[model samples]
Each structure stands twice: as structure tokens, then as C-alpha cells.
Target: MKIGIISDIHGNSEAINSVLKNIKEVDEFICLGDIVGYGADPNYCIEKIKDIKCRCIGGNHDFAVAGKVNINYFNYAARSAILWTSLPLKKENLNFLSNLKRRIELEDNVFAVHGSPQDPLLEYILDKDTASFIFSKFNFKICFVGHSHLAGCFSFSENNNQVNYMNFSNGGCIEINTNKRYIINCGSVGQPRDGNPKASYGIYDLKNKAVNIYRVSYPINLTKSKIINAGLPRSLADRLSYGR
Candidate 1:
């Protein structure tokens, strides 16, 4: 089962469209969430994902737009985006976001969540201890997560009882080892903060037992212009280029 895993789309249809073009062969599509948030075209992104019936969990932004979460939890800019995003969304899309699960566990024991499984919609597993804690919480060997907008993988070695974290900033991959456990972050599509500025996503190859992180250079300016045109913060437009 070749799975196309995408996350943190943040309403950038340009990025989503570009990313989808690169992975058309995958048998299944799994979206780790944030289908709408900090860019333009929220409705399009939502409709696009629904068109494919993407297996997606609810992201913080998604919940915020659906009024399931308080905007107080987000920064002012994000809160503004969410508030603005809510205004134009169709009732069906709002219901769609509302129906999204906080976490999804595939039959093969693959877990997908907007954040870490421990806190599904909020925790940022950025260090070893966090990773260790999350790995301990889930019995599954591999879990795919979004939310920090950083593309990377965390590996736990039972022999040493240690967990290590590294970024796939340069677009690297891991040859999945069944004897070990993994926490893979699929990064952000709409807004990438890995310092590379490229759109990031992942591929999970079930037959070969491997996970690959891939990057594509989308039209950042187009998204930037859209953000600016929509009256979103300039900082939001600026960050897309810096990937900070």
C-alpha cells in the first residue's frame, strides 16, 4: 500500500495542487490535517481534499474554523485567519471539518494525527523526551503526525532505549526498520517552517517498509500574493519565503 501523506495545508491550494501533481500514483491519500488556516483559498482546499475523500484528521486550524476550539489558543494572526476563514466556508465544509477525527489508526497499526498521539491536536514532539513519551504511549511501530510544520523523523531504538530526532530539511528519507519504532512528521504544505522554504510531504511504502520525505518548490509568490490580497498579515506572506 503506497500511501500519500500530506499535512498542514493551511489553505494554500497552489501548494496542494502542486504537491498532488507529484504523487498521483499513491494508492491512498492520508492528510494529517490543517486543511485550512493561514493562506488564501480555504474553500478550495477543503473541496479539493473532499473530492478525493482524503483520510484526514482534524487539525488545530480546522477545529478553530469549525468553532470546536477557541481562537484564544492561536496567535493573533492565526486567530484572525481562522475568524476570516470561518466567514466564507460553506456549511458543508464546516460540518466536514467538524467531523474530522483527532486521530486515526489504520488497520496496519499506522497512526495519523494532527499533533502527537498523546495530545492529538496540540503537542509538538520536537525533542527526544517528547518523542520518547509519545513512543511509549502508542504501541504502533510507526505514527505519522503534522502540526509543528517541520518535516522530520524520530526513531526509537529498543536496544539502547533511546530516541533520536532529525529533520529531513534536505528532503531525506528513512528505510523503515521493523525492529524499531518511528514518529514521522510530514511537515507543512501551506506554510513550511523547516528553513528550506519548499513544500514538504511524505510517502509511506508498505510493501518495502520505508518512508520518504519529498520536497517541491511551489509558487510561493502566488500564495504570498493571495495572502496579502486577502488582508492576512504581511508576516504570514513573508514567512512562506523564509520557511521559518
Candidate 2:
């Protein structure tokens, strides 16, 4: 099965639209959450995801918008954006966000979560120590997550019990070593923070046991204009091009 993995689509419909156009042949889509927040067009983006019927989970932003979590931990801009996103959302979309799960297991061995396994909706696995700890907490061979909005992989080799962190390369394809376990960050759809301006996504080919990362350039100006017009923080609009 070929699965398209997307996450942190924080309401930027343009970015997600570009990604959908780029990768259209996937068998199933696994969304890792943050379906709304930080950008404009929350309803539009939510509808797009709903139309596809992608398996999704609640993100921190999603929780905040759904009033499921406190926005106290968020910074000024993020808090402001979440507040802006909370209003004007459709009832169905709000319910979808409200009912989203934190984590899921697919294909028997593949685990999916919005955040780290240790803390499904919040903690980020940035370093080897955290990654090592996560490896011990989950029993799956392959774990996929999003939230950091950075595209990459962390692999723990069973042979040496050593770990390696690899950034996505050109063409963005990584060979999956079934003998070892891996934790992959599918990156962000609406807001990418990997220093790359393009939107990021991933494809997991279960048949080949390989993961392919992808990035698509969308109309940043369009989303930015929408954000500004929506009365959201201008910083929210400005950040799209910078990918901060």
C-alpha cells in the first residue's frame, strides 16, 4: 500500500492543494494533525481533508482551536493565530478537530502520531536521547509523526544499537531498512519550518518498505494575503515565505 502522509496543515489550503496535486496516486492518506491553525482558510482546508477522508489526528493547534487544550504554552503569534482560527470554523470541522485522536497504529506495524509517542499531542522528539527513549516506548518497526514541521528520519539500528539522524536529500527518497526501526517526521503542509520555503509531505510505500519525502512550492503570497485579510497577525502571513 502506498500511503500519503501529511501534517501540520495549519489552514494553508494552497500548500496542501499543491501537495495533493503533486502526489495524486496514493492508496490512502494518513494525516498527522494540526489540520487548522496559524494560517487562513481553516474551513477550506478542513473541507479538503474531509473530502479525501484521510485518517487524521488532533494536533496541538487543532486542540487549541477545538478548545480541547490551553493555548497558554503558545507564543503570542501562535496564540493569536489559534484564536483567530477558532472562530468562523464550520460545526462539522470543529467536531472533527474536537474528536481527533492523538495517535494510531496502521498496517499492523506502522505507528502514527501527531507528536512523539511519549507525549502524543505535545512533546517533540528532537534529539537522539528523546528519540532513543521513544524507540523504547513503542513496539512498532516504523513510527511516523509530525509537529516539528521538519522533514527527516531517525533510525535505530538493531545490529549496533546505534542511532542516526538523516535529513531529506534531493528527490527526497529514503530506503527503509526493515531490519532496523525508524521514526520519520512527515514535515508540514501549511507551515514548513525546515528552512525550506516549499511545503513538505511524505509517501510510505509499504510494498517496497521505503519512504519518499516530497516538497511542493505553492502560492505563498496568496495564503499570506488571505491571512492578512482575515485579520490574523501579519507575522503569520510573513512567516509563510520565510518558513520559520
Candidate 3:
């Protein structure tokens, strides 16, 4: 099965729409969350995801927007977006955000989470040590996570019991090793922080055992203008162009 994985789409409907247009012909879509925070058009983004029939998990931002969690935990820009999102989501959209799970186990033995497996709404497994620790806790051959908005993959091989980080620039297909395990971050659909600034997402083919990360261009200025027009914080709009 080919699954299109997306996460951290913080309400830039333009970027999300652009990414969706490129990823044609996938069996299923899996969203790792943050559908409503840090940008404009929270309701529109959530509606788009639902239209695409994506299997989603609630992100920290999603929880905050739903009033299930406190917004004090977020930063100034994120908190602003959260406050904005809380006002606009309708009853059905709010329930959709509320009903999302923190994690999902795909049929192909891959586990998906908005954040780390250890702490779904909090911890980020960035380094090898943290990745190794999380790998030890889960027996799945592959675990996909997103929160930091950086696209990368870490593989732990049982042969040497070592963890290795794969480079995105290589552009090679990653074969899931049955004896080993992997933690893959598909990056953000609306905001990317890995310095490239383009919208990042990936397609995973379980049958071919290959994963390909793709970056697509979007109208940053258009999204920025939307953020400013929505009365969201200007800093949030500024960051999208720089990808910081």
C-alpha cells in the first residue's frame, strides 16, 4: 500500500492544497496533526483534510484549539493562532479534532504519532540517543512522527544495535529492514524549519519497501498575507518565508 504522510499543517490552506495536488494516487492519507494552529484558515484546513479522507491524530496545537488542553503551554505566536482557531472552528470540526487519536498503528506494521511514541504531545526524538530510547520502547519495524517540522529518518539495526540518520539530499528509496526499526519524520506540509523553506512531505510504499521525501514550492507571500489579514501575529507570517 502507498500512504501519503503529512503533518504540522498549521492552517496554510494554500500550501496544503499545493502538496495534495502533487501527491496523486495514494491508497490512504495519514496526517500527524497541528491542523489548526500557527497560521490562517484552521476551519478550511480541517475541512480539506476531511475531504481527502485522511486518518489523523490530534496534535498539541489541535488539543489547545479544542479546549482540551491549556494554551499557556504554547509560545506567543502559537498561542495567538490557537486563540484565533478556537473562535472559528464549528461544532462538527471541533468534534473531529476532539475525536482524533494520539497515535495510530497502520496495517503494514508502521506506528504513526504526532510526536514521539514516549510522549505523544510533548517530547521530540531528535537525536540518536532519544531515538534509540523510543525504539527500545516499541517493537514496530517502522514508527513515523512529526512535530519539529524537519524531514529525516533514523534507523536502528539489530546487527550492530546502532542508530543511523539518513540524509534527505540523497534522494534514494529507503528499504525498511525487517530485523531493524525506523523512526521517520515526514516534516511539515505548511511550515518547514529545516532551512529549505519549501513544503515537505513524503510517500511510503510498503509493498516496495521504499520511502521518498518530496519538497514542493508554494506561495509564501500569499500565505503570509493571509496570516496578516486574519489578524494573526505578524511574526508567524514572517517565519514562513524563512522556514525558521
Candidate 4:
């Protein structure tokens, strides 16, 4: 099965639409969350994701927007987006966000989480030490997470018991070795922070045990204008071009 993986959409409908248009033939979509925060068009983005039949989990921002968590923990830019999302999310969308799970185990022994395996909404598995720590907790062959908004992979080779990291720039397939375990970050669809302005996502071909990291250009200015017009923080809009 070819599954499209997306995360941290952050309400940028334009970026989401561009990604959907670029990757048209995936069998299923797995979303890692932040469906309604950090940008404009919360309801529109939620409706679009539903229309595409995506399987998703709750993100930290989603939790804050649902009032399940306090937004005071968020940074200034995120707080602005969370407040905006809380105000405009339709009742149905709010219910959807509230019902989302923190993590999901795929049929092929792969796991998905918004942040990290240990704490789905709180921790970030950015370093090899953290990745190695997480590897000990789960028996799955692979764990896919998004929250850092960076497209990268951390693999623990059972042979050497070593962890290694690789960043993917262009979209391509990667074959998974059964002998080793992997923790893959599919990256952000709406907001990328690895110093790349383009939106990022990934495709996992379960049959072949391969993953492809994809990036697509979208109308950043349009999203920025919407963010500003929605009364959200201007920094939220300004950061899109810089990918910070």
C-alpha cells in the first residue's frame, strides 16, 4: 500500500492543496496532526483533509484549540495561531480534533505519532540519543513522527547498535531493511522549519518498505496574507518564507 504521510499542517490550506495536487495516486493518507493552528483557514483545511479521507492524530496545537490543554505553554507565534483556531473552528471540526488519537499503529508494524513515542504531544526525537531511547520502548519496525517540522530519518542498525541520521532534500523512495529499525520524521506540510521555504511531506510504500520525502512549492504570500487578515500574529505569516 502506498500511504501519503503529512503533518503539522497548521491551517495553511494553500500548502495542503499543493501537496494534494502533487501527490495524486496514494492509496491512503496518514496525517500526524496540527491540523488547526499557526496559519489561516482552520475550517477549510479540516474540510479538505476530511474530503481526502486522511487518517490523523491529534497535535499539541490541536489539543490547545480544543481547549483540552492550556495555550499558555505555546510560544508567541503558536499562541496567536491557537487562539485564532479556537475562535473559528466549526463545531464539527472541533469534535473531530477532540476525537483524534495521540498515536496509531499501522498494519505493517509501523507506528505514527505527532511528536515522539514517549510523549506524543510534548517530546521531540531530534537527536540520536533520543532516537535510541525511543527505539528501546517500541517493538515496531518503524516509527513515523512529525513535530520538529524537518524531513529526516534516524535509523538504529541492529548489527552495530548505532544510530544514524539522514536528511532528504528531493523526493525519492527509500527501501527499509528489516534487520534495522527506523524513526522517520515526515516533516511539515504547511510550515517547514529546516531552512527550506517549501512545504514537505512523505510517502510510505508499505509493500516495498520504502519511504519518499516530497517537497512542493506553494503560495506562501497567499497564506501570509490570510494569516494577517485573520488577525493572527504577523510573525506567523512572516516565518513561512524563512521556514523558521
Best by TM-score: 1
Q: What would the per-residue lDDT of candidate 1 be over residues 115-231, giving only the tens digit for each residue?
A: 888888888988988899887878888889999999999999888888988889778778887578999987888899999888998888888988889999899999999999999
Better structure of 1 and 3 per lDDT: 1
TM-score quality measure for candidate 3: 0.96
Tell me the spans in candidate 3 whose CA falls farther than 4 Å from its real position. 169-172
Per model, state how many residue pairs clash.
0, 0, 0, 0
TM-scores, all candidates, are 0.97, 0.97, 0.96, 0.97
How well does model 1 score by local distance difference test?
A: 0.89
Q: Which lDDT values do the candidates have, in the order given? A: 0.89, 0.88, 0.87, 0.88
| Model 2, CA-based lDDT | 0.88
The TM-score, computed over Cα atoms with residue i paired to residue i, of candidate 1 is: 0.97
lDDT of 4 by residue, 1-244 (tens): 7999999998999999999999967999989988889888899989998998888899999999999878888998888778878887789999999999998878767889998988999898889999989888877788999989988999988999999988764445567997889999878999899888899989888878799998899999999999898888988899999987
Model 3 gets an lDDT of 0.87
lDDT of 3 by residue, 1-244 (tens): 8999999999989899999999977999999989889888888999999999999999999988888878898898888889888887899999999888999888656889988888898788779999988878877788889898888899999999999997553234677777788999878889888777788888989888878888888999999998999899999999888877
**How do the residues 77-148 of candidate 2 rate in per-residue lDDT, one tens digit apiece?**
899989888779889889989998888777888889988887889999888889998888777788898989
Instruction: Give the number of colliding residue pairs in candidate 1.
Output: 0
What value does the lDDT take at residue 168 in candidate 1? 94
